[model samples]
Target: MSNATPPGWYPDASAPGTDRWWDGTAWTAHTRPAAQAPQAFGPPEPFTAASGDATTAARSGTRIAALAVAGLMVVGAAVTGAVLLGRDDDPARPEAGPSGSAPPSTTATATPSPDGSPAGNDPEVLVDQLNGITLPIPDGWEKPDRTVEPVPTMRTVDPYECPGSSSDFCYHATVTSRTASATDITSAEQLARQDITAAADRAYEKNIVGNRIHGGITSHDQLDSAPVSVAGRAGYQVRWRVNTAKGPGGYVQSLVFPSTVGSESLIIVRYAFDAGPDGPPLSLMDTLTKGIRPIGDSATSGGVGSSIAP
Candidate 1:
């Protein structure tokens, strides 16, 4: 018998609850126990259902499903490992989904750092004394002008460095903090998202980035937004995209958390980048976010902090 189903896992001809490997040319002896969802785990578990549906919006809402642990499984296929899990739908990545799509990862897994402020002297990191927010900047990233005053902005941190045209080709990271009243925002997530939208509005109105396909100028296509915790505090995050001079190059993500000074103040850690299919993606920004830490907090201990969604 001949099989022309392309090289992939197919229902085993002889076994009812199993899948056999088809090596493009012929069926191989390799067989594994099968279920409705073909995951990279051995012995099907109850959670594979949710992880298999990770592409859908509903799956992202229910991020804590036990099977999601296996979502990052680096198994059998490189394409599967690279595409399906970790962070999917990044506009900056070559594998990003259609326009106005958000990354599949709604929540960031917080990796804890040492207690009471990171070693501030390290040049790789940028610390905001006013807001008490610290960012682990990548190498070669030029610092924001010392004279930018009040609103601190870091330019040319993007993988695409444009010599004087930062306002157009490259992305800028800005730290904005504001006084929050009880009625100002209901949740940390709301505040963060508002700040993100505000940033996008400024960019679009100023021609920093172009308008999104379905959304008007100063408006954006929100891919995903959720409440998350970073540095042991309540936080909110949003991911969105807009049009840019370079095709579809607007992918923006912002993490908003409380300032160390008091609950009344909120800090917005905004990441702006080119989400186009070309150039580098948000991987560098992800690395920066994972390394974010607070400069002063006695409650923070030396051990790594676990990331949790509040």
Candidate 2:
């Protein structure tokens, strides 16, 4: 007996129209006219192999074009990155510190102290000899006398004050010492007026040490103050201007000495040529005052002697 076919079997194209083929769960094969098949579906065209040379050429051209475009992009990115980095590294940019916006600090150099010596060449010493002394004599200024007889003293080689050519006034050094009580001592106001009159009275056509002029004690009231310390004694400096026969004159004289029982005050007088003109440098006065030292024990042991020269 022939084998029976199952339901849903269809004819197979490979076996021809009379033969049947088994279909699993559904019809697996079918045939239609060429026109009808075309209307519904068509056979795929055969794929032909391309020439190796043509294919390789086209692929190489595409790859080269892609690589060129990629290279330009990379170069552009690199250039941009370099430019940005350079700007960040520029030195002119503000630097960051612990205090977010603070700028860098700078150090300042210290100034040297002025030389404190009799001749401006010796190191300053803290001796008990002279205290709060000052002088303005130029370096190597001649000191005729260096020894202290009865008082700590300093003298300049050249007379600092001289009479002007147009006036009868003469320049001289006036040394005055008073052993009276502070009450007896002239007030600072009185002393200043006295100094100006003294300068005018002592004025001569030529400078002299002690040539006196005849005149009443007229007062030229002008006064200013400065801080001073002498031999551990605190005091103030008094300065003023006065008119003399020579013209308007300038003067700076200070009396700073210890005010104790035996303490003595010394006044070194400096007179200028005229107002508005350069006068004797006050530096000399500074040097003289700084060089002032107490007389040795032997000199002041029996109370300050009276050998002090004005």
Candidate 3:
């Protein structure tokens, strides 16, 4: 008898508890109650040759096909909605992450001179204010036309020298916050994980080839998820890295917190940096995160800080 499970009756991959007919090569729409199906679904396809080499090759092909399907499923789940950063791509392909290449030399130096105080110092300020929240724009950084879902605000640090070279690309930094439905969401950590997972799944679907066995995440790693406090509320944070269609990209860091007024309102902060080795120093991310504050919570707002650190 062939090792292959003969077609006739098999559990449907898509629907649980329902039996579907497998005509050896593909599944048929025919269905019947699982309990009512006979033990034998159908006879296995006969081997054309009895030689050992032929049987081995046949089994190898089947295994390879199965592996391909498994890979596709994993990639599909991870890449969905990950490219929420921007929509600069062929509509047929997944959207690539935000591109922060230095504008034409005529635009301005990658790093501009500070307006006043050094970057990350002046706290009484706000950049790209929205949703009753604000960010502390560091010195030498400039607001650019970059936005992503859930209300994105982008600030770029110019003169950011690219890795291993003297050249620089406008380093892109973005902060976005959005409220998600709390229905069935038990904890803030869960919310953060869900969002990150969704982003990854979206990215994978768009970038990875549908052919499962041959395509998947180029490379990826995720840091441990941790608990955090945001605006006096319990929250969670998660970080991960993966190679994207454009290049290496991932959520440098993300936070999710919840508030209760009438119903549960989950707030999320997603911080993304796309410049790689030429990217802004990680310390800058710390400064901005510490400086974020909900509007109307402070008496005197912070002063505008210089983008260029003096």
Ranking under lDDT, best-scoring first? 1, 3, 2
The local distance difference test score of each candidate is: 0.44, 0.30, 0.43
Instruction: Name the top TM-score candidate.
Output: 1
Worst lDDT run of 10 residues, candidate 1, spans: 98-107
Model 1, CA-based lDDT: 0.44
User: What lDDT does candidate 3 reach at residue 222?
Assistant: 83
Off by over 4 Å in 3: 1-131, 144-150, 157-171, 200-217, 245-251, 259-264, 299-310
Which residues of candidate 2, in runs, are more than 4 Å off?
1-137, 145-183, 186-223, 259-278, 283-310
lDDT of candidate 3 over 125-243, digit per residue (tens): 44322123455566655544432232434455453432222332324454555556435676788778878765454333231222221022466578658887665667788766655
Model 3 lDDT on a 0 to 1 scale: 0.43
lDDT of 1 by residue, 103-206 (tens): 11111221111211222233444555444455555544544434222343444544343322443333443333233434456567777767776666544334
Residue 43 displacement in candidate 3 (angstroms): 70
lDDT of 2 at 8: 18
Name the weakest run of 10 consecutive residues (lDDT summed) in model 3: 94-103
Across 265-292, the per-residue lDDT of candidate 2 in tens digits comes to: 3333333223433344444344434433
Given candidate 3, what's the lDDT at residue 146?
30
